[model samples]
Target: MQSNAQTPDQYIEELPEDRKIAISNLRKVILENLPEGFQETMSYGMIGYVVPHSLYPSGYHCTPNLPLPFLSIASQKNFIAVYNMLVYSDPTINEWFVNEYTKYSKAKLDMGKSCIRFKKLDQIPFDLIGELASKVTVDEWINIYEAQLKR
Candidate 1:
């Protein structure tokens, strides 16, 4: 697949203040800890980072773009979301995420196949979200994808 023309700086620059800050902070956390080779681009009108198809030809199959996203973040009309496919595969992880998120149950949750949604930066658990991001290292992602393949 061809690389996206949209650069991270350019993408963030076009965002509104609230979204920009949210995306910027999330991007900061991701870049600081995520492994290199991950690329950010505009996908479906939201900010998405993934390993290119060049690296994972079958697609971060488990991730949005296939073979890339262990983590994904997005800005929507009503919320910001972070998706972790691994959580869906692990009951323990989902349970723990729910438990951790209960501290703010009043916040809305927009869950998709693998996305978690929240309205504000404060609604997200910075430390716990970071922890969730950390859970998906390269080895873990391959293992998770391999396990999914068997299913």
Candidate 2:
């Protein structure tokens, strides 16, 4: 299940055994919770669940030309991570994410522009992760993305 992130794999190659497992676990959680059609792709050295342009038509992440994406996941040098731009943009959800993730993870959890990083799978709040993932449907994503692109 481990694939090197080094070159073409773009997703899970360079990761150690533990990291690979963690990433896969996280991916499963995301997939189970998300709406279908959000593709699994490699972007920015991590797993990115992309909103295809054919479906959205406006653009990925809703912009006509902005292809940044709507969600991202990764197995970094120190941790496994997840990123959801829609949630990231909202302060309410950001606080919720931090509060929820801290409950189970003893390791350091890194939060960035949109990414959430943790050292172990046990640290992630599976319930919260599912909740977040399920909330935004592909249609909602497209609308928001289009609006973002307008900006």
Candidate 3:
């Protein structure tokens, strides 16, 4: 569900007790592994990791005033969602993530284009998510985003 919380800490604090730990740990994993230059902030009501305007002034095409979003984690109604733009926009990364998911968790992959859904909190693979977060840098994400825009 979308949150009205202004900060990442606030967002986590608002979650139900059952979800608090999973979302918190996921946020921790992302913060620990996300590349330099990506800032953690509240974006689109989720805990977002974005390339700020100082790094890429053009901002997001859909919302030019906002920073360019690369990744986000949220507590959804039925599952926790991890949205990674790199996984959605880059076929190589998608293939790699899909291939590697099986090695990490016994749960079958439940995913949308960029949204990875984890229903069972205990089954979440924090290491795999961390590795995914580290797979792309801010500059690389900007380049990829620009390339897609040109298409």
Best by TM-score: 3
Over 4 Å off, model 3: none
Please give the CA lDDT of all the candidate structures. 0.68, 0.68, 0.95
Clashes by residue pair, model 2: 3-12, 3-13, 4-13, 4-14, 5-13, 5-14, 61-145, 62-145, 62-146
Q: Looking at model 1, how many pairs of residues clash? A: 7
Error of 3 at 78 (Å): 0.5
lDDT of 3: 0.95
For model 1 the TM-score comes to 0.75
Could you give candidate 1's per-residue lDDT for residues 15-129 as a string of tens digits? 6898788878887887777766666666544566665777666675444454455676766668778877768776777787777776745675556667887776676666566
RMSD of each: 4.1, 4.0, 0.7
Candidate 2 vs. true structure, TM-score: 0.74
Candidate 1 regions with alpha-carbon error over 4 angstroms: 1-5, 35-45, 51-57, 62-66, 103-110
- Return the TM-score for each candidate structure: 0.75, 0.74, 0.98
Identify the superior model by lDDT, candidate 1 or candidate 3: 3
Displacement of residue 96 (Cα, Å) in model 2 is 3.4
Q: Across residues 1-151, which tens digit of lDDT does each residue of candidate 3 receive?
A: 7999999999999999989999999999999999999999999999999999999999999999999999999999999999999999999999999999999999999999999999999889999999999998888899999999999
Mark the regions of model 2 whose C-alpha exceeds 4 Å error after superposition: 1-10, 60-68, 102-109, 149-151
